[model samples]
Target: MSAMKEYALGVCYAHPKEMYDLYDLLCGWEIAERAVEMEIVERFGGDTYPSKDMFEIMQGIADILENIPDEEALVMLKMVSLITDKPDLMEEELSFWRGRCAA
Candidate 1:
């Protein structure tokens, strides 16, 4: 979680001064991930990945979280907890992924 700034969207603007550096920081973050995705296509992207795999699932949800306009993705996350009937564990898992997604 500490290296969240390294990812394209894994950051929270909880302070005022952060806004001043947002543009550059965000661009750098996105570029860094893009580079990795380019070099590690088998692991990071493409259609070969199975939907049931955790990495692929999380990546898909992360993409949804990153692209959507609002907190709408939270609803889908909530549905995951309902389907699993594990709200408590899902709560913590959601926090970690949200920290990872930072959406």
Candidate 2:
């Protein structure tokens, strides 16, 4: 399974009855993921972006819309869109991913 899927499964398992909490956890994960992506970009000093992954994640969240509800998914989608739209953020994430790939 993908890292995101694994994380989601873990969240579901950990909070089976707390759907709202699961949503919160997913949002938190996205925030942290974006932050790391930004830091990575600054660290690598690269101009390349990782928009594909951002979009993939956005789609993933969208896929969960039925389970999460439109309102909640919209909020998550907005966050994902904000991150994807920012070039600086994309660079940061790519820089980080590049480093990880190199390592």
Candidate 3:
């Protein structure tokens, strides 16, 4: 999942002191696959999926996260987990929380 960061929302926030950075919710984590579905519909013209396709799905989720609000980041994260085929990313998101607590 290391390549996950390539399209991560964290890349948009380079300042260490910015209060609204979404890294706490996105670091080493992946978004819900449903979010990808919604995104694909917006990106493309339809919602029907082929038998098996993940490329467009991932790109769509990344793009949706790019425009979401921080207050809603957590909810979005949870939604992504519930709707996707992937495991829940709560642990990874909380890892950031734990690091912040220690810092």
Clashing residue pair totals per candidate (backbone < 3 A): 0, 3, 1
**Candidate 2, residues 1-103: lDDT per residue as tens digits?**
9886575445433323333322332343444355334423433355534466554543444344446544343343333334554556645644543454344
lDDT of 1 by residue, 67-95 (tens): 53333333333323232333344345445
> Would you give me the overall lDDT of model 1?
0.34
Off by over 4 Å in 1: 1-52, 85-103
Candidate 2 total steric clashes: 3
Q: Which regions of candidate 3 fall more than 4 Å away from where they truly are?
A: 1-31, 43-84, 88-90, 97-103
List pairs with backbone clashes in candidate 2: 37-92, 37-93, 41-92
Give the least accurate 10-residue stretch of model 3, judged by summed lDDT: 14-23
Model 2 TM-score (2 dp): 0.27
Worst 10 residues of 2 by lDDT: 16-25
Per-candidate TM-scores read: 0.25, 0.27, 0.27
Ranking by TM-score, best first? Answer: 2, 3, 1
Give per-residue CA lDDT, model 3, range 1-103, as digits (tens). 4554443444333222221223333334343355445544544456544333344445534554665554444444443344245344545444544565455
What RMSD does each model have against the real structure? 14.0, 15.2, 10.2
Q: Return the lDDT, model 3, position 94.
A: 45
